[model samples]
Target: MASRGLKFVNIQEHSDARGNMRIVEVDGGLPFVPVRSFIISDVPTGKTRAGHAVSCDELLIVAQGSCLITARTAAGLEEHRLTPATGAVHLGPGTWLMLSEFEPGTILVTYASERYAETRFFEDYVEMDR
Candidate 1:
C-alpha cells in the first residue's frame, strides 16, 4: 500500500507526571499551515461522511475514539484506521475521501490549507478523474 499523494504523519506526544499532550505545527507533523479548521463528531452508527475531493490540501486527526478513512487517488484506493495514537493523515489536492465506521463519541478534527469554497469541491469522483 502506497498512498500516492496521501501521507501518514506520526505525532509526537509529550508526557509528564501530569498528563499527555500532542502538538501540531507547520513543518512539524502538520504539512501545511491551516487556514480553516473543523470538527466532526456525534455521528450515528452505520453512516459515512465526506464523499468528495477538494482542490486544497487537508489533514485529519482523530481526537477521540476511532474511525475508518477511505481515499481514492490517481494511484488507487487506500484505507486507514484513525485513532488518537495513529497520528494524522494528510490528504493532497484531488484525493477523494470518505469517512465511516466511527466508534461512539468519535471526534475528528480537520485542518484545511484553504478556506471553504463550493467551486473548489468535486462531489463526483468521475469529475476528479478528469
Candidate 2:
C-alpha cells in the first residue's frame, strides 16, 4: 500500500569545507511547531523504523550515517534518501513514514510538536488517515 502518492519530501544538505564537516539543524520557526526533540539509531541493516506520524508537523535530520525515509500519505508515498550532514525533513499529520535501508550506524534526529505518547498512532495506517 503506497497510499496514493506523496506530495514530496525534502532532503536538506549542509556542508563545511573547513574540516569537511556538515551539520543539520531543525531550528524553530516553521509552519509546524516543536514540542519534543530526539534521535533514533542502532537500527539493524535494512530494518525500517518511523512507524508513526505527528498530529501537527515533524522535522527530521540525519544526525549521522545515512538511511532512506519514505513518507506515505493519502496522496502517495514519497521516498527521501537521506545522508549525513543534511538538513531536516518536514512531515505533517496523516503521514506514514518508514525509515529503512540504513547504512549501519544510521542515526535519525526528529523534532515534534507533541510529547512521546504511545497513544499516538505508531502503526495501523488506517486510523492515521482518519
Candidate 3:
C-alpha cells in the first residue's frame, strides 16, 4: 500500500475556533495516474488491512489519525508511520502492502490510476521474488 514512493509532504492546516481543514495535492508522477480518490475510516485498534497490490500505481495519504504501513518487495522493505499531516506514499505495481496498528479514526485517502483488480498479490514476503 505504502511500500513505494511514500514521501512526507508538508501541508498547512487551517484551524479556527470552529474546526480545522487539510488540503492535499492530487497530482501524480509518470507511469502512474490518478483515476480515482477515496477514503477509509472507522478502523479498530491492533487490526491490519490493505493486503493487495495493483497493476497501476497509487498514492496513499493519511486523511486523519495515524497508522503504520509495511511494504515488502524483492526490491526491499519500506515502512511508514503516518499521520494526517503527512504527505503521500506511492505504491507501484507488484508491490505487497500491509496496514497495521491503526490508531482511532485513521482515515486513508487514496488515488489510483486503475479500478480495483484481483490479480494483484497479497503481502507474502518469502513467497515472492524481488
Output the number of the lDDT-best candidate: 1
TM-score of 2: 0.69
What TM-scores do the predictions have?
A: 0.87, 0.69, 0.71
All predictions: root-mean-square deviation over Cα?
A: 3.9, 5.0, 4.3
When 2 and 3 are scored with TM-score, the better candidate is 3
Please estimate how well model 1 matches the true structure, expressed as its whole-model Cα lDDT.
0.83
Worst 10-residue lDDT window for candidate 3 reads 121-130
Q: Tell me model 2's lDDT, rounded to 2 decimals.
A: 0.64
Clashes of 2: 8
lDDT of each: 0.83, 0.64, 0.68
Q: Would you list the rank order by lDDT, best first?
A: 1, 3, 2
Report the lDDT tens digits of candidate 1 across residue range 14-112.
999998888888877578889999999999999999988757788899989999998887677788899999998888888888899999999999999
Best by TM-score: 1
- Candidate 3 residue lDDT tens string, 1-130: 4444444445556889998886655452323557677787887877788765555676777878888988765467778798876666777766677788889888888777777663355445343233
Off by over 4 Å in 2: 1-29, 126-130
Sorted on TM-score, best first, the list reads 1, 3, 2
> Candidate 2 lDDT, tens digit per residue, 1-130?
2233333335534456654443333452343556787888899876778666545567777877888877767666577788754456677666677778988787887767688782266565643221
